[model samples]
Target: MENLKKTLIKAARKAHQVFDELKDRPSSDPIKIESYTGYASQDRMFLKGRVLEDDNIMVTKSYEELKRIFYSFKRFETDEIPGVKVLLYLDDHEFQVYTDEEGFYTLDIATPDSINVKPGEWIRGYAELPDIVGDDGPVRGTIKLRVPDSEASYGVISDIDDTILQTHVTSLFQLKMMFVTLFKEASQRLAMEGMVELYQEMSTTPVGGKNPFFYVSNSPWNIYPMLVEFLKLNELPSGPVLLRDFGFGMLHQNEGYRGHKIETISHIFRAYPDMQFILFGDSGSKDADVYLNLALEFPDQIKTIYIRHLKDTKNARRVANLINQKGEVDAIIIDSTREIAADAREKGYVSEKFVLTEVEADE
Candidate 1:
């Protein structure tokens, strides 16, 4: 493992070197702050975004879908702006942050103790590059942060690759995964059969409110924009999307190296201690083991777990053994959305209308 990590680091350094050499030293290009949806507690706010020299590639092509695949490669070949100080404004408060070597900035700062928010409400803010100017003022990034409602029953923490989106993470060399992730546009990408409806149903609360959904994926942050667009196009319930850093930065994080999903979900759980969660993953990854063990540790907070069956016998058997070992939490393998909906109905996690409306349709 140590040797393999060293090799990956060396390769990453080379890639970074290549990117640095290819970019123009001083150009008239515009710099922009690309922000993602953030989540917050009453007393603290957690946020992240990137500073990059905008490529100015036209991403939208209503007529030609394949053009996006060509542009996605350019997004991966990012023109990062590093060591730049950024200013973030939340209401009347101000916070200062700086971009890392990868042009990514992460903020976990204290909010005013007097701040009050109802769970499920979104707080709006903005991030600005102090040095970058626009027609009126500095170029800014609009930020939205979600505050979980204590009144809600549970939130969802789901895997993106196979559980929701149809990225074949199990394919040889992950070639199929790369093809779908890179070559396909957001509209061209496929969500699993019935997953769209299932997730939509899952988001509907009994009081007609929407429960929160957090997406935890091992996908690098470079594809954050692509994934966000994919969710919007597919109409999946959007929340804070916690993706890993790419290249050398990924290897340095101790917890992230152990399991990105695990570390990310644990942080979410800690953030909303009173809120229960319905865990979702696929059998293709180590999701079963990670989620199952988490259920043991936070048995009270985890309502149940659903593992999307991918026909991996060895992994399935291993998950089965773990499930048997800790039968306190309800964990099951499901081959279809219909199965999950049926189980969820029995447990009162979802509405009767959801199962009746979702399962009665074609698979």
Candidate 2:
């Protein structure tokens, strides 16, 4: 009887040890969703975001440029949580989407008659993540989208670097671009002179509602927040800011990179077939090339082209020669916003009373 009692006691001790071990094991880290600024048309609303482990996530917090850059670095290096289920909500509509291998979730919903999205403003929706830390059920991440206003005369499609912000990407080996990107925060970065007012003028229509702006750049999606911050801090008009999603070695750079700008712009054109656009870019990179190609394909939809002149380079020279050659499709190699305002007045894009803020030309 004593031996049996001893065995029972030993089993009880083993059970207690197992319970202690189980109690001490760490719980899984909560998840997070990074939803990007999305856009919609009459029929289709597209949104793209990512699922990631909430631990070790860094956003732009530090005011110090050096610390800020490191924070940006760490933010980009965070791992994506793939194969997660995300529930997307747009008003009374709900959709289920699965993250791809890159932990990116894309919501391409076709709501022809369901969603009554109007233009000239942004609409807000939320994503339901797995759960939050509290008893509040699933965590919610905010998502925003813009649709074109019916009163919009023409939408503005622009490049971010050099065209809007002063990112001198044409410098030898891109030394200046690298320095500005790595050492400077978005607040420290400068936009092109007179561009803010010029773009603001362009963003308004003759009537009440505001015209939309679509910003595209060769910069990767890792700096998406930084660019968005730059736009917001500078008070630049906001729309959908699209950037390269590849080239980090996190995924193959060239996999979907071939004709990326062309493909992206093409998609935009397809989305708003009835609406026309004015294209803006710098001579640097393939902006000129891509814009010209788009003009060729969508002649009726392209209203005009404005390219900011860069330092004398082969591409710049080539664009200069090709500007006047595009027959009836007015492409201007602009030196200042005065020129833009003057021509915009002629094109009826702006009011005749809209005056230029800058008196001097940009050199």
Candidate 3:
């Protein structure tokens, strides 16, 4: 019995050592990379990258196992790459490998022990920059690739102005000033407290196998870099960002506002009909209304909708009423980002999870 125990321990140690070695191996060939400056809202930005692939990839393990493998890369970060992060569940995870002197990080994933991820479950890879305290900080970037054994294919569709950056669209003048400045000064501002947590939640959520995050914003294209810088400063999650170009004609229709957020959501739903979505936005605009409408229209596709309350407004009541009327939707509205996170742990959305922090005065 003692001999058998010793053998088991030795095997485990050997397996761990092998994993460590595998984590450190470099890619065999240089791959083509594309970089984009992604804006989360008016206040946040993320530097995102993707390694294009023409062939199908396979991943081994259950969806849970695949998620775990992706996350296992977390043990390998050095001080030189502060922005290096990992997202995983079961056997699948993504790593933000170290960057070069040019401030670029490449992603390389080894074929898994088994191939379980179906063609529909494959997803692109992405990373967010590390939060920097000062305005003049370095930019952090990430790269992604397909792995063997993955069974899910996914993509992200997110809100832009408030969800990614700090732009408050409700006040059109402030929003315009934010645009006029090109978000230069504002992008350097500190991240809102709990924003990191909120972003982390968004990035790591399990969506159709392993899709890349897709960000949709109302801000015009010129300030895309500013938004990316803002996300780096906040150390938020990274994904493919879609920004509104002023020339897109919709801006002309919205009275100078550049994005058709509702339409964009509809487009995403149409694009990936089988994919699940984890929606993030604020109460300053029509996010709540849009998400509510989405829940009504496509009940199965949306997994969760997280709305951050910027002010004490009737929007929360209206959201609640809408949910009550439909009797569907796993949604919540909260004064702070942390509360929204806490509620996420519960299986279902409870009123207590989204209760307002402020109290109303008695008439």
Which residue runs does candidate 2 get wrong by more than 4 Å?
1-30, 54-62, 131-136, 247-258, 359-363
Tens digit per residue, CA lDDT, model 1, 1-363: 989978988888888778777774887778888898889887667889998888865433443546665687776887788888999887767889998878889888666775555577887789998887967688898998899766567899999998888898878787998988876766677788788888888887888878889999888887787788889888999888889877556645664355777777877887777789998998888888889778767787898889887766676677767766766678888888889988998888888766534442245
Give each model a TM-score: 0.89, 0.84, 0.48
Span of 10 residues, lowest total lDDT, candidate 2 = 246-255
Task: Kindly give the number of clashing pairs for every candidate.
Answer: 2, 0, 61
**Ten-residue region with minimum lDDT total, candidate 1:** 354-363
Every candidate's CA RMSD: 2.7, 12.8, 21.3
| lDDT of model 2 at position 90 | 81
Q: Regarding TM-score, does 1 or 3 come out ahead?
A: 1
Question: Residue 74 in candidate 1 has what lDDT?
Answer: 77
lDDT of 3 at 354: 41
Residue lDDT tens for model 3, 1-363: 989966876776666456555644553332223345322211111333332211112112223544533322221121122133322222244334444322233332333444243332334344434332123342323333222113333344567665555565556456653542332333344454555554554444253233346667766543444556666656665555555534212212444442367766765565456667778777777777778887788888888887766655566566656545645677776666556656754633222334333332220
Q: List the residue pairs that clash in candidate 2.
A: none
Error of 2 at 335 (Å): 1.9
Model 1, position 144, has a per-residue lDDT of 80
| Candidate 2 C-alpha lDDT tens digits along 1-363 | 989966876776666456545644454756678788888888777788887666543344556656666676765555565677888888767778888755688887665586868666666788876534435668678888888888898888988898888888998899998888766667688888888988888888777778889887777776777788889988898889887655222333455664657877887888888989999888887777788888889998998889978788988888888886877776888877678888889888888898877554444
Supply the global lDDT for candidate 2. Answer: 0.77
TM-score of 2: 0.84
